[model samples]
Target: MKYFLYWGCSLEASGVNYLRSLKPVCEALGMEFEEIPDWNCCGASVSYAGANDLAIKVLNARNLALAEKKANYDIIAPCSSCYIQMIKVNHEIQENESLRERVNSILAEDGLAYNGSIRVRHIQDVLFNDIGTEQIKRHVTKPLNGLKVAGYVGCQSVRPYGEYDSVHNPVVQDKLLEALDAKPVPFPKKIQCCGSGIFLPEMDLCLGLVRDILDDAVSHGAEIISTVCPMCAMNLEMYQDRINEKYGTDFDIPIVYLTQLMAVAFGMDLKRDAALHHNVIPPENILKAAIGN
Candidate 1:
């Protein structure tokens, strides 16, 4: 139940609410997270597009080295982008001696070295595989009462590394919601790309992707969409108005983190534990469904 937490750039900035909601949810579940000291960005997919392999690997390797020095716990990143970046580096270093040597040599400047002993995992993977639904059910004080929800499992979480779940279609979030008495609606675009990495550069394309996901969720009778990644949540929730303006459609969908939904079911404080106030599209309906207030 313990892991080295890596709070990437988003969690500290635009994704702050995700980190806020995560704290109490993990606390309620008896999960302990020791943050890796002085951890840098995992050099997201966007970074990979611009930077060289060595630069990205070095960034993640420094984090792995810090975690190794701190303790023997596995590293966990709540952000899907961070999870993929770090895991890719961890996977690569473990298999390629040349890559490891190069990364370690760069780290040597900072008096750090990564032996690739730690495992990098997404928080969703840990919650679904390690924590289990039974344990989660036991913590649910306020069942969702069949609240229709779409489990948006964005692209980065499962793709290219389907260790615990399917790459194209993941059900961990849906299964977890079911345990909380929430009815998971059939969302075809659950694993759809939100175009997060290229959102700024390709605004139109990203909006189309976001609009499609939201459209699918709304069409399937989802009252709200639960997400695992902050980037996805932000893209979906924050851009609804823009999407409506651009597409000549009226769409107001509430986007929430899966952990936030868990917090609601656990009967935790909406503002404190769930950080519902932070959501762009206020999930007032979700609040009413879960707590009947």
Candidate 2:
């Protein structure tokens, strides 16, 4: 199936590895994706934090309008924050006539408006629901036979949106790994917040939260952790060193995008995908071992 792909800001820069992985995996699955042109930022938290509801809605509406203009009703967003924002604003504009009129008023100036006909889908939903485990397994050239991976769905993908999966118990990522013939190591902290901004103001709290999650994964015998959200991956990948140093643990766990492993499991062109370049906890050797490259 073809959909308008929205790359949000992070996926292009901070999470470029995710971009690298997703393209090849989607191609492998015969899924066609075309990026929405002139897509603007979703302003994940900044717009909402300052009570700029109108500004934020307008910003999100612009992207939706762009997709609608392109005649694509389904928008596939890989970033959890971007998916949540688009879905949230789309729902609000559809349900509230007042909000819709207000947003339209602002959008009228630019000759763009959101009609709420667009459906925003996370890639996780596309992989699990649309593609299905059986279909994905058909493409697995090398099964992750002995690999143990913990699934982390994190906060943004579930709560406040709950469009694709459950907030309380999400197993989409784990199932995707299973499709690759890998062992899905379950953990209690799978759906917990990865402490996105908590690390900056309260280092202790953030460190404790991250350390606990990693500890649980390791204790469960997880060699790597797979997450769909870039923020979740970032928090786990970026701050793992501090978590280890502060907690006196020797954890060197690799946190990778679900698509990265998918590319490997599907036996796509890993070298061209360049999936191993971004994350601090590199997945090159781990993935090579899985596919016996």
Candidate 3:
């Protein structure tokens, strides 16, 4: 199988390590992973600002055009924001020809045109759909038995304007965990927003929202929180200290990327996989305990 690896600006900057790790893993699994040729920023964070929708659509259309030239394979985005923006805007452009023409006019500058020929998908979807749970299970060199994980499907990846998965309940992460031989703990705030894009103007509000979600996960006996979004991982992992101080509680749940956990389950070296870069509480200790390491 082949895929166009689309890394948007946010991921290209701070989350490059993840892309680096995933590429090798995919290659080892006998998948052809190619970076989109002449890719540019997906105009990150601008799509949600109501008036800038056309501009965002045009920007993503450029990237899609680039991918279309490469192959007919699905464009796989590791970042949730990129996935949401690309998928949602593609849907919009296909539904509105007038809007598509307007966006194509902007793309004409770069000699790019989008006909909505390709589909945008997250790495999670590709892993589950194309790779299959049985294939993922076969890669699990070390089973994470007894490890209780709370799957956090950040808003953009599963909800709001993009309805890629179930809005109220999503089990993609759960299925991935099961393939790793890990227990998926159900929590109330699994689909809740992690205050991703609103962190700047609403810092306190973002922290409060994250705190509530973390508390719910802890209450549900989740030792670690797994997520597909880098922004969600950053907020939940990096802001835990402040959240604890403000709420008079010590919630040190480890925030792990879904890929990171899968890498570990696949028996990839934790240090080389860049799992150590996470700001949240380290999950290695808990994971070791669960596997009797």
Candidate 4:
């Protein structure tokens, strides 16, 4: 199986290690991974706020063109924001020919067109649907038997109409966690927004929202939070200290990317893989306790 690896701005800037870890795992599972050549930013959140229609159609269409030219396979994005933007654009272009034409006119400058030839998918979708649970299970060298994990789907991965995965009650992350032998803790805020794009502009609101989510997860007995989005991981991990100071609560929950958990279950080196680079509490001690290391 061949896939076009689409790394959005955040992943390229800070989450490159995740792509590094995922590629090796995919290769081991008999999948050919290729990066989309000359991929640009997915316009981040500003594009949507400034020009919703043009932003979605143009930014996502450009990335799709690159994938079509290079790999011609489905594009797999590790970043939830990129997945959302690309999928949103593809849906809009296919559904509305007029909008598609308008966007294509912009792309014509670079000799690119959005023909809807490619499909955009999140990493979780690829892992759960394309890769399958049995294949994931085979890579487990040290199963996470007693580790309790909270699967954070975030808003982007599940929301927006006509998307690949269901918005409410998403199960892909949970399935992946279960397949790795880690217990998936159910919480009411599973699909809740982690104040994603608003983290910087609205610090108090973001921290409060995150605090509530973490409290809910902890209340449900989640020891570590697992997420597919780099922003979600950063928020959940990086904001714990501020939240603790504000609320006088001990929110020591560790945040980890789903890729990191998979690497650990497969007995891959955590330290060397930069798993410890997270700002939240480290998961090493908890994982070690689970395996009695």
Q: Which candidate's lDDT is highest?
A: 1
RMSD list, candidates in order: 1.1, 1.6, 2.1, 1.8
Task: Output the worst ten-in-a-row residue range by lDDT, candidate 4.
Answer: 271-280
Backbone clashes counted, model 4: 0
Write the number of the candidate with greater lDDT, choosing between 1 and 3.
1
Cα-based lDDT for every prediction: 0.87, 0.84, 0.79, 0.80
lDDT of 3 by residue, 60-100 (tens): 88888888877888888888888877887888888989988
Candidate 2 yields a Cα-based lDDT of 0.84
Please list the residue runs of candidate 4 whose C-alpha ends up more than 4 Å from where it truly belongs after superposition: 49-52, 162-164, 277-280
Q: For model 3, what is the alpha-carbon lDDT of residue 10?
A: 61
How many residue pairs collide in each prediction? 0, 0, 0, 0
Sort order, lDDT high to low: 1, 2, 4, 3
Weakest lDDT window of 10 consecutive positions for candidate 1? 284-293
Best candidate, TM-score: 1
Q: For residues 1-293, what per-residue lDDT tens digits would candidate 1 score against the true structure?
A: 78888878998888888999888898778889898998888888888678887888888889999999889998889999999988888999999999889888889998999898999888888888888999999999988989999999988889888977899778888899998999999878898899977887899888999989999999999888999898898788888889999999899878888888888899988888888888888996666756677
TM-score for candidate 4, residues paired by index: 0.93
Over 4 Å off, model 1 = none
Would you give me the overall lDDT of model 4? 0.80
Ten contiguous residues minimizing lDDT sum, candidate 3: 273-282
**Residue 40, model 1, lDDT:** 85
CA lDDT, candidate 1, residue 219 = 93
TM-scores for all candidates: the values are 0.97, 0.95, 0.92, 0.93
Look at candidate 3 and give me any clashing residue pairs: none
